[model samples]
Target: MSETMTIAPEQKAATGNSNKMLFAMVGIGLMCALLIVLTYEGTKPIIAKNKAAALEQAIFKVLPGTMTTAGYYWDGNAFSPLKGTEAEGQRVYAGFSESGTLTGFALPAVGLGYAGEIRVLYGYDPAQEALVGFYVLESKETPGLGDKIEKDPAFLANFEALSVAVGTDGNSLKNEITYAKSGEKQNAWEVDGITGATISSKAVTEALSTSTAEWVPRLYEAKERFKPQTQSHE
Candidate 1:
């Protein structure tokens, strides 16, 4: 003889309560997701504006005498005013004086640091074959030590006229920028590392060397395309 299986009243009650709790949890989770999405959407524009402002300030800071800036896109052949969306690997900003004379080129550079990636903006003087200025845009370096790259006067001095002269081949840098031991810089292309932040300092040097090696030749070849407008500002 077979006997039918039946759940007790108490068991059924418990199962119903469990189902209700599950539904409640799922609803709460969906509500939290919706709130997060709404908050992000609301703040996105403000974040973008702040970022743009910061970048503009950094551009001016790195390129001394830059009263205004014009965005340009390098299409591997020539530079033209940037229009519409930015293309990959086509970033270039031209700084102009109050009189609209071309000041310098503020180029973005990045490299791996002791902790993580370091980003910087540097001014390149085509006429001088040198990097004339530098500003650390972002870094995950150790505070008080690695961060000295932004404030160390002696280290910062390196970018004032770091050489990037073309090689005999006429297409590559004659010397790669390198960092020397603190107080050991012996050449225009050598940067003096910070006293206690050797790795971070080296990161800056490597970033500049690698970026300039690729960009200097291209910018030098396209120099004619970046002529000043000659329109004086009132």
Candidate 2:
């Protein structure tokens, strides 16, 4: 029985196998943890600085002449956060000229494309009561089809001070936003839909409708409130 029992060399081999397994597990775990920590440390500052710079760039693009953030209200969602409210999802950034006059509204807009969500930064001129310009922030649309919304200048130019005839009923506008053929569009609210690219055109039109239909009225209200007062007593 002793002859068949585990000898010193056999016991040593078993211990070596157990030790090797334990060491390998510990080494793998340590490597994973170290990679996580290093990645976080390397990326944290870059992420924050990118966000800040993006805001600065947006402010510059939307409202040129000045580089200050003083008068800008963090209108979290096309409305002021008020005195003591918490900021939440989405932020509507308003820009002003150097003279402290309202220039336009820079809103964050998004829509679902055939592949995924499309994001944009759009500016609306309160004076003209129309869209001034827009830039695509992100999109997962098809490369040659739906992606035209971002690259086509004519498509981009379609948005201007499109007018909305409000109904007396007050729930929604009288006329919904429309896209027509080029030169056929007469109103500030009408756009020239893309030819042979109906889906892309429809996506853009629907996005504008969903975004502006709700916020434009609110902006009208805000414009009235924030309008510089002229003397009344005459």
Candidate 3:
């Protein structure tokens, strides 16, 4: 008779244990992936709500006198009430006063900073041709140096009524915002740069300049569309 082939008892046990360990590892990985997906799904709505709330607050802050706000989508032709996620092109948030009059527009702009991109929200008063308010939305700037763009009171003053008058062409800024040397601001459109944070300060100026160059004319042309609805006097 042929010798019977046999796996040693310990060998068989080791093999069984190895297979069990592999299965356990695979099971754990799948469980981890499932948990991650579940967690993302569960928290998505809350995260969205928080973001929306923050943006609303920022809109009010940047566009002073705003008691209410509405989002609009600019499709290179007109501003329309946002439908679904069609926030493509230039998105604008119109701020309205308690009396239901349109106050100003909150526009987002981003530019390169010392460390990275600096994002800002600014309020534009089409009537005044000025930037009335400003708030830093996000920045990855140097701690003490570049961060001054957000913290410096002197820098903040620049946006209180920075001029962005349309040029005679009616399609471009008469004078794009420029960073003036400390204490040398000579015009309404000049911004005084932070002494130590020139790059970051310049970034904000450039961001607004570029954004307004593209949007101001369009918005001015569509100003009537932004007016609050009034009951017919008839």
- The models' CA-based lDDT, in order, is 0.82, 0.63, 0.84
Tell me the spans in candidate 3 whose CA falls farther than 4 Å from its real position: 1-38, 84-89, 227-234
Which has the greatest lDDT? 3
Q: What is candidate 3's lDDT per residue for 1-234, written digit by digit as tens?
A: 775698466653345488789999999999999999999999998987787788889888888898777778787677877664764246788888989877888899999999888999999988888999899999999999999988899999999899988888878888888879888999999998889888899998999888988988777777768755332100
**lDDT ranking, high to low:** 3, 1, 2
Candidate 1's residue-wise lDDT over 94-136, tens digit each? 7777787778888998989989999899998777888888999
TM-score of each: 0.76, 0.67, 0.81
Return the clash pairs for model 1, or none: none
Clashing pairs in 3: none
Deviation in Å, model 1, residue 163 alpha carbon: 1.4
Q: Which stretches of candidate 1 lie above 4 Å from their native place?
A: 1-49, 83-89, 227-234
lDDT of 2 by residue, 1-234 (tens): 357654566353345488789999999999999999999999988986687577657655544342333222345344443232333224555555656677766666776767777777677666776777667777877788778887787887776456654556654665677778745777667777766566666766777778777766666556644431131100
Off by over 4 Å in 2: 1-31, 55-89, 142-145, 164-171, 223-234
Looking at model 1, how many pairs of residues clash?
0
Q: Name the better of 1 and 3 by lDDT.
A: 3
